[model samples]
Every structure is written in structure tokens, then in C-alpha cells.
Target: MPDLNIPVKILGIGRYLPERRVSNEELARLCGRSAHWIEERNGVRERRYKSFETNAFMGARAAENALADADVGLNDIDLILNASGTAQQSIPDNAVFIQRELGERAAGTAAMTLHATCLSFLAGFDLAASLLLARRYRTILLISSDIASVALNPEEAESFSLFGDGAAAVVLSLAEGESSGLHRAAFKTFSEGAELTTVRGGGTQFHPNAKMTRAEDNLFHMDGLAVLRLVRRHAQDFLEGLEPGLSAGLGAINLVIPHQASKVGLRSLERYNWPREKIVETLSFLGNCISASLPLTLYEAIKSGRLERGDRFLMVGTGAGLSMGGLILTY
Candidate 1:
């Protein structure tokens, strides 16, 4: 069994939304669909988009909010983690840039990045639990942000209408309490889903330098049907793997703050007998912000009072690796 005794607690959470909010009507015009058609399909009325903000820039903004909310001074941060799917640039990671923008006190602080696509936040949380418990760092700042709209294919309404731009951050600190920190965590990946959701360009596999590189290769693509099928097959096993962590079982989970992958993506939990009301959702407004979805939805849940401190909640997500992961914890 994995270590289920980590004592790190979430101090604060914050998110930053782009200035522009694209409504379904605006999106329908692009794809030649009716507003009602879009809404009925994705359950997304609108979503934000990054007009000029860079990924790292938006992440810095969200980090400031979380740090202030946590009542933590910049000097108190021991490490900065940029846990997102996309990078501001391919060269230097976004961690140091965020730390620098955060404030001078954040200067000289150790910085790094963890990439797990949409599961970035949960992956960071799982890693932080182990690292914090080991005393490797006193206070850690993890930020997840994505601007997926730029790369979306306009013709692919199913994918484009479901993606948005946003950022979310969380502050984690060591604390003493059985119900205040992570109790259990698990993740599963299926390489068979490698092509289900992909952006084939920008990497060595489809490098610009390569003669065969196509413009479509650089844009985001998704085999939505394949993704749904794959998840349906694995959903049960994923839940079963997580059952050992809960004090009770699925019903004992106060809330399931899931990734806002889609309308169907969230509803898919119904098959596992999860209560609809117990599932926290931000997809209708925020759509899918890649790595930012979970953290942003989590921020919404707490702000809306759907979740409370000491409440055992499960954070779950499915992403690019055809990966599935979850953390059973008390917020």
C-alpha cells in the first residue's frame, strides 16, 4: 500500500481568468452551429481565453492571490512548482519566472516543473504530500495554468468548444491533523490512449525542422469518442484502486472535484453510482482548461461552499496519457 499518512494541508487556493469570456453564441458563429446546439452538447455556456497573457504570466497572477490568501509571505516560500501541461516557452521552465514575478522574496528560491497534462495539479499534490512529509520543504507553491484556445482547431467544435484558458494556484503547508491533509492517492495511465487527445507538433516527433510537418500536426486534436470509450472501460478499476483510502467507500466521499473535461466526462461518474450532487463542476462556465481544470474547479467548490475544511474529498482527472488519477483527502 502507498503511504497514507502524509500531513501536509492546503493553505489557500486562487485562480485567474482571462479578460475575454467567449459565450456559446460567439463560439457557434465560428463553427456554424446554433448556440443551443453548443450548450446542449457540452454544457458550457462560456469560457475564458488568453488574449495576451502568457502562460507563466497568468500563473504568476494566480500564485500571488493564493499566497496572499494563505497569509504566507513571499519570503516563506521554500520552493515554487509550475505544474501545468503547456510551457510558456520550451526553453526555461515557468517556475523561476513565476517565483521572480511573485516578488523579490521569492528570488533565490528553488523552482521546478512537473508536467502531467490535465492531471498536473493532482500529480503535484501527490508528490507534494510525500515531499512535505519528508521535510524536504516547509512551504510549497504549486500553480497550474493553460491557454488551450490558441491551438484548438476551429473546425473541431467538439474539442474547441470544450477548451478554455485559465490558471489556478494552491499553497501547501505542513500541519498536524488526521482530517486536514492527504490520506490516500493513486494514478493509472494507459498508453493505448496515446492518440486519443494529441497535439502532434512542437515536439521532436513532429518537429518544425522535419519536412513532413503539417500545420494540422501543430494544432490540438482529439478523438473524443475514443477517449470516452477508454475511460468507460477503466473508470471502475480506477475507483476500485482508490477505495482503500476512503474511511467508507465512494459514498463516504463528501465531494469529487473532477477535471472539467466535458459534460459527458463529468457525468460519466454516474455509472459508478456516484451521486450527481456530490460531483463538483466548473465545466459549464470554465470549460476545459487542461491542467487548470481541477484546481480551478476546486477553487470554485470552496468558494461556493460545496466543500469545507475537514471534508474528505476526492480530486480526480483523466488526461492525455489516457491517464487517470485521484487523491482522497480532507480539504
Candidate 2:
């Protein structure tokens, strides 16, 4: 990567979790394992499961909250960007549905989708920054909504117990000055490990309605150990590649908000000597919410006052592409 130094800022952020809370005990019954086994395996005690909340509904709600937090209205948004791992449907993009769910005020707003699995938000943040810098869009609404529970494989206790459903949104705009913006953005995908985590169906390769598609084809699958191994192999070099001396410590970084991949995934940072106190985590309660995990964790950090304006923080994570991404920014 190169020095982006994009002058973009997160104007507001918000998250929306489903009303239903699924506890590990409940999941154990479905997976035929003990609650303790689920917890020990994934470090998730409880995760939200959607009842009737469609992806668009959840996303719109979160976007409304974000707009409120930013002190802006729907009509003020210049673009609507949907960065989600899962789509509400196959034909139309998810962003348009989110725009529709936002009601008439969002009519005619440019909408599209950009997905990088779990790194969707990070990638979107990078793109949004460039757009703002180029003066293409003044105020961008970025939303991530994932309904992981729908695709979970009950037979796979580990992955089944590791994911949850949620939505998160952020409003981005140009920073008034050079004070708050992105300092660095880097992403790399290891295509060799792409098959390690995926839902092999619902695409052109494995159409959901195709007679050849098996029930398992539509379910989420993961070779947890393999994914971890690949990440471990490249995480160090990748971090240092993002910014020199980053592997040793955060240096001037005030906080680190990582994707809530899992209990072990978040804890893996300790191996690089990153301080635990500096990392923000919401996995225990939220589980791995796909792309929403990163921004949702960021939302929690701001709400808790751990991350405040003028503070520099690093957002980094691994996603389904067997990809690792990092963005360093000042809040």
C-alpha cells in the first residue's frame, strides 16, 4: 500500500441488534453440545438472532440512528453504500433495499454494494474516504447488515455457535481540517485459503434453486484451524507491512477495534505484543457478526468513551476471503 492519508472522518456511528438473544445454552441444544463446550470453543456467551428483521429493515434502522447521531437527515445523504457479507436477495443489490427501507426521503439516492466478506466495512471506509477526498460525495451513508443465523450449519457446532446477526452503520464526510482522518489503509487477500470459509451456494456456481444444490451447499462452512493457521502465517508481516513497528506495539495508536471474528481471533493480537487494554471487543455478547463486527465494535468503543475525537485508532481484521485488512485513523 501507499500513504493514503485520506482526509475523511466518521461523522456518526450506530448499531442495531435483533431483539432475540440466543444464548449458548440454546445453541448447545441445537448443536448437540454442552453450553460450556460452545463457550470454550468460541468464547461467545450470547448472540443476537433475528426474528423478523430483514437485512434492509435492520440496516435502515441503524442508518437512521447514525443519521441522528451525525445530526443529519436522510435527504442530506449524498450516497448510500451497503457493505455486507450477505445479501438480502440475489437479484437486486442490498443497498437499494436499504434505501427503500429508509422510506421516500432516501428516494433517488445513489446506492450500490461493495462486499469483501467480513472486511466489507473496512473496504467501504477506504472507498468512502477516497470519494470524499475526490469531492464525489459530500455525505456518505455506509451500512452493514448480516443475518448469519439464517445460514448457520447446525451440524457444525463450532461455526454454528460462533456467529450472530446484527447491523451497524456509519456516516462519513470530509474532515474540516487535517485533524481527523485516515492515516493508512491496507488489505491483502490469500486466495489459496479462500475455500477455508464460505457459503458455497446461492451464487451462479451453486444456485439455490438448482436441483444439484445440496442443503449443505447453502450453509456456512469453516475450517477454523486452517483459517487460523493461514492468518498466523501472514498476520505479523502484514501488520508490519501496513506500517513499520506496528507489530511491536500500537506506538501512537490510541485504540484498536478489531473484527469480532471469535474469542481466539481477538486474543491472537496478544501474540504480537498488542496490549489487551487497548483493544476493543464485543464478541462475547455479539459473536461474529460478519462485516458488522468491525463497525459495531467501533460504535461500542465510542459509546464507552474509550475512543474519542482526536484519538488515533487502528481497525484491523480477517475475513472470509482469508483476507486481512487494517485502517489507521484519527477519530
Candidate 3:
């Protein structure tokens, strides 16, 4: 049986990428490297930048696009869930801003956020699906948006060169129509990697006002090699934790939309027996959009005709919390 017994479907999907394109050369100049150096190391040729775009602004625009794509109206969304990797602000809740930007169409609705770093979007997907099954919400707009550029340390070329800014969102509803339904969802974590990938500053532990806060504390950092090694070490167990459902899910899904985390990490999925051609990747061009990575890649897959309705998919990735998550569903 699938993880989710109740049928749920994505009614629409949308993405908003900034017009300012940052090529490998531009990022290289910032880090004192060549374009080839960056690409050869991380498989990133270029990435998008918010420039003047706020995370909330990009999110709202993406939400609009998704609503339009789903043919869903503002009034149709009963819940607005911001499942972003980072909030635009520490207060006021970024979801409210997204709701306002969605115009009056989003009035009189509940808005909230569910955070798990890059895994937030996948968490939101299951959240919306569960709510639909419980009949608490008729429709949901789940969004994932992050601007890693601002928090990046240009001096940390390995990490800095691999980030981009963007947002991707989806409209989900109970499978009352003829569209495909959500079939399964699963998430696993090894908290030992909690500090492996993190933005050590801006939170309660590393606040700006803290006397001992170092400048680098506020910047995003990842022990890239360590993370890859950890994932590889736990690869079999992690995949096994996903169980019989996962085994079948691998065969059942038509495409795999993975988090655009790293070149080595992505290629490792093939070791699980997944077909190379069946994986959808956007890390080379889009960089890692944090929480937006999965959905952004999903948008790319759909736009490129790699995905179509009635298709089965497995969305999976690892994130800051040392988390591994994936979902099997029919699109």
C-alpha cells in the first residue's frame, strides 16, 4: 500500500526565477576562480540571483503562477503554507507577506510555515496531502523559496558558487478530479549531521546581538565532503528505512526529482538502481535553491516535457538537518 491512502493531487505548479543571471564567470570572479574551476568542482555552470527580489516577493509571484497553472483562484486556496528553507525575516512571519502579495484573493485564510531546511517543501507536500485527506482544507498552496546568495560567503568558494535564488510552488487538492494522486511519502534523518550543513547565525543560538558571535556565524556553510561521505555511509540504511514501499516506489515512479544539492550526492542515486536517464536534475544551471530545489527541478521537468500528468514520480533529497526525504506519487 502507498504511504498516503487518501488520494491527493497537485492541481497546479509554478516557479519564479530572477531575471539577473549569474554565470560561472561572475561567481568565479567573486571567489577568485575560473568558470571551469567552479563547474568542474560542483557541476554548476550558472545560477539565478534575486538581485533586488526578496524571498517573499519571488514566492508570491511563483504562487500566482501556480494558481494560474492549476486554474485555481485565490479564493480557492484554503491554506497557505510557506515551507521555505529560510524565512525572509525573523518576525511577522514571511507567509503573511506572501499572502498579502497574493492580493485580496488570499483573504480570510490561515497561513503558516513548516521548516526543515531543504526538506520543508516535501514536508509541506505531505502536510497539504494529509489536510486534504482529513477534509480540513479543500485546497492548499505550498511554496518553497530561498535566497542563498545573501547568506553566502563569497570567500567560501566551494559553497558560495553553488547557490542561487529562486522560488517554486504548487497547488494541491484532494483527488476528487481525474488527475493523478499522491501515493506515498517518507522522511529520515541522522541528527549527527545536524551541524554538517547550517547557517550558524541569525537564530537564537547565534544571534546578531550575541557577544561571541563571529562574522562567519551568519554565513551558510557546509562540510560538503563530510556530508557526501555521511550520506554514502548511510545510503543503504536510509534507502532501506523507506522499505517495501520504497522498493516498489523506485519501480513505480516514472521520474525522480531530487534535491539539487551536489554533484557527487546526485550521482550516488544511481547506486540505488535508479536509471540515470530517469533522474531530473537542474543543479548545473540553477544551482541549489535550497528548499526550492526539488520544486524548481519539478518545474523544469514539466517544462522540458520530461514529466506529464498520469506519470508516477519519486521526489527525494538530503538537507541541512542531515535529513533524507522522498515521496512517491502519481502526477
Overall lDDT per candidate, in order of appearance: 0.87, 0.93, 0.87
Roughly what TM-score does model 1 have, to 2 decimal places? 0.96
- Per-residue lDDT for 1-331 in model 1, tens only? 4648677888988899999999998988898788898888889999999998988889999998998889998789887888999976777777867776777777899999999999999999888878888899999999998989888887888887888999999999888755687877889999999988899998888898899999999889999888999998887777777775232347667898989988888887776767788988889988899999999999999989999988888898898969999888888
lDDT by residue for model 2 (1-331), tens:
5777788888899889999999998989899999999989898999999999999999999999999999999899999999999987987888989999999999999999999999999999999999999999999999999999999998999999999999999999998765898989999999999799989998888997788999999999999999999999999899999999898888999999999998888889988789999999899999999999999999999999999999999999999878999999999
- Where does candidate 2 stray beyond 4 Å? none
Alpha-carbon deviation at 218 in model 1, angstroms? 1.0
The candidate, 1 or 2, that scores higher on lDDT is: 2
The TM-score leader among the candidates is: 2
- Alpha carbon lDDT at 204, candidate 2: 88
Return the TM-score for each candidate structure: 0.96, 0.98, 0.96
Ordered list by TM-score, greatest first:
2, 1, 3
Provide the RMSD of all predictions against the true structure, rounded to 1 decimal: 1.8, 0.9, 1.7
Per-residue alpha-carbon lDDT of candidate 3 for residues 1-331, written as tens digits (9 for 90 to 100): 3356558888789999999999998888889988898998889988998878887899999999999999988887889999999877899898998998888878778999999899999989988888988899899999998999888998888999998999999999887756577666778889999888888888898889999899999898899999998888876766666546353337667899999998877887887778889999899989999999999999999989999988988888888868888777788
